[model samples]
Target: MKRAGTHRSDSERIDLTVRDYGLDGGIASAHTVRKRRIRRQTRFLAGLAILLVLTAGGIWLIKSLSGNTAPTTESSQPTTRPSATTAATVTPHPTSTPVPTPVPTTTKPQLSAEERQSLLQQAGDEVVHYLDQVTTGRIGIYFQNLVNGESWAHNDKMPFVAASSIKLGINTYLYSRVAAGEISLDEVLRYDNRAYPTGDYEAGTGTVQNLPNGTELSVRETSKLAITISDNCATNMIIRRLGGIDAINPWLNKISGIVDYRQKVSYTNYAGQSQNGRHRTCARDLGLQAVRLFSLWQENPQVYAPLIEDLSHTEFDFGIKQGLPEDLVVAHKIGTNGAYATENDLGIVFAEEPFVLCVLTEMASAERARKIQTDIAAIFYEKVASWPWP
Candidate 1:
């Protein structure tokens, strides 16, 4: 049995030991049984080791084929989303991000070119009808919508007596000077006989008017007086301050092509003699002045807005403001001469889209001129009121 155990085949030795060492064996048999028992234990242990090796290989092969090597342990659970990266221990993966839903919006109405033209033509027809009805004198009208820059005119290019309507030009130059820093609103001006002479600008007309003649007024105060009350003396002083009427014409020529009167023909320019045809303007010229003024203010509000603001509060609103709601802010200038029977109103009407309107009338009664202007303005305003235009 000893020779077969180690120096012989293991199966043969196990057989010999089991046969010789029966259940009732002697002391020698006991030793053989112990050896046999040890052999059985060794065989069982060997089988278990082989089975363990096979189980470990199977786990590795499954992990490789599935493209995952993370152990079934705490190391596999990540704290954050695993990135698409390979690591020495475990290869990681990326997860998808979700999308969100959107909301909607809105817009405004717009006018086509043909549609806008029709509206303008309708307004023009009404203007002509009203103008034809009144044959007492001549009437010229100008209108422009600031939004689309569309304009309509009737007898706009013909010359008309530029009554106080010329004041708009004079004051515009003053403001331009102020804008250039050549003049200041705060600077003091003399309303003396030199600028406002004895018969000039009605220095001799009223005691109240005469009182302020030799007195000093600020440039601001003078400008306000010129437009608000159509003060001739105040206008003369501004003309003087701006270095005479000749100095104002170059700027006027650029805007209107018509200049101020050369010789006085009426009481409006009581200070100077008026020239009728030689010093005349069309509705277009006056309308252009306000349009230019408005444009300049839009470009530089700090320097020129004061002119618009001052004109907005004029004391004389008879021609353009007649028959209109008091709430409509009309920044305008009016000139009327009973001798020439001329009534003129030129202004920037602050509508939803502010516009310029200049109406000049001659040889007509003041009452007639006023009615025509109001009616013409109403026609345009009616159309402008509904213009939430492009």
Candidate 2:
């Protein structure tokens, strides 16, 4: 019985062993199939990755060549505006060019000669009425409209003491020489007491006399002093340099009919004539001088620039300027000889309608003369302001 049992166990063991071996072989075959399937999947994934890389590279190269990396907004389908209702529609408006508006121009009023003469006569009568109130002294007035050339004169031919107004002739002659290039404005001049002796130094408007002897000044500087400050010493020096009244008279007469009946240098030995006769100028003549000077300045500004500039700096402003608006400019010169009781102002008024005025008074108080001047200026200003055009 023991031998038979042992034999049975050995058979059972052999059968179990064969079954185990079969199971192991089946597992090995299944593992080999799974490895093959994995390899095939890996190869397919790699090929797909390569295809994607090549497609991306081609797209990048095309964008680089075209220089257009910005995203495009192009659509394959046509777009339509949003509508509240499906049946709603839109219509485009017609386009057209616009026309500009035209601008209008201003025109000036023209007056007849007879009308102008009548107006001038009316102005003269008004001025005469104003002068009638002054019972004490002789007054002369000359006025002319620079634009229309209409003029009026009241005792304008009567001569008065020129006083510092003679400086205007001196200045005109000096500039005339400059215009002719006979003398240079840059020439240096010595102001010695001997040249304009201390005895000849008049005690009036000036600074050149107060300056030390042997002081040097250019012709231009001396002229400026003569005109702007009515520097007596400076005037004498210029007159001496020009060779006295004889040298200046011919030039004055030759140009602009400006007649100075007795032209004399200021603060000189020969300047002490009678008050009636010392350096006399008529209102008409002085007015003409101012007109000529303005014309000269307009014609040759380079030569007359200094004279115009000097006149613009007139230190005395109690005459025509007092009556004028501050905005207006008056290029003027005032002459007052208290010894002779003469007061005169000649100037070009740069009003809307410019004019020349010369007011000469004798035997009147300074205040009265200034009042007459201011009134005369106001009359002209009113006339100009009321004029129809600029």
Error of 2 at 38 (Å): 42
Measured on C-alpha atoms, candidate 1 has an lDDT of 0.74
Worst 10-residue lDDT window for candidate 1 reads 96-105
In model 2, what lDDT does residue 76 have? 78
Computed on alpha carbons, the lDDT of every model, listed in order, comes to: 0.74, 0.75
Please give, for residues 1-390, the per-residue lDDT of candidate 2 as tens digits: 466545557778667655654444455755766787899999999999999999999999998978776667866775685545533655444222111111112335366767766777877778888888763677888898776778888888776777887788778888878888998999988786653433225567888878887788999999999999889888877887787767787766664444355553232111334433346777887888888877777668778877877886778888887888775667789999887788899988876667899998886478988888998898877866675653
The clash count for each model shown is: 9, 0
Show pairs that collide, candidate 1: 164-335, 200-271, 201-271, 263-273, 263-274, 263-275, 264-273, 264-274, 265-274
Q: Give one digit per residue, the lDDT tens place, for model 1 in 136-184.
A: 6677788887667788888887666786888898898899889888999
Q: Pick the candidate with the highest TM-score.
A: 2
Score residue 42 of candidate 2 by CA lDDT.
100
Candidate 2 has what TM-score? 0.66
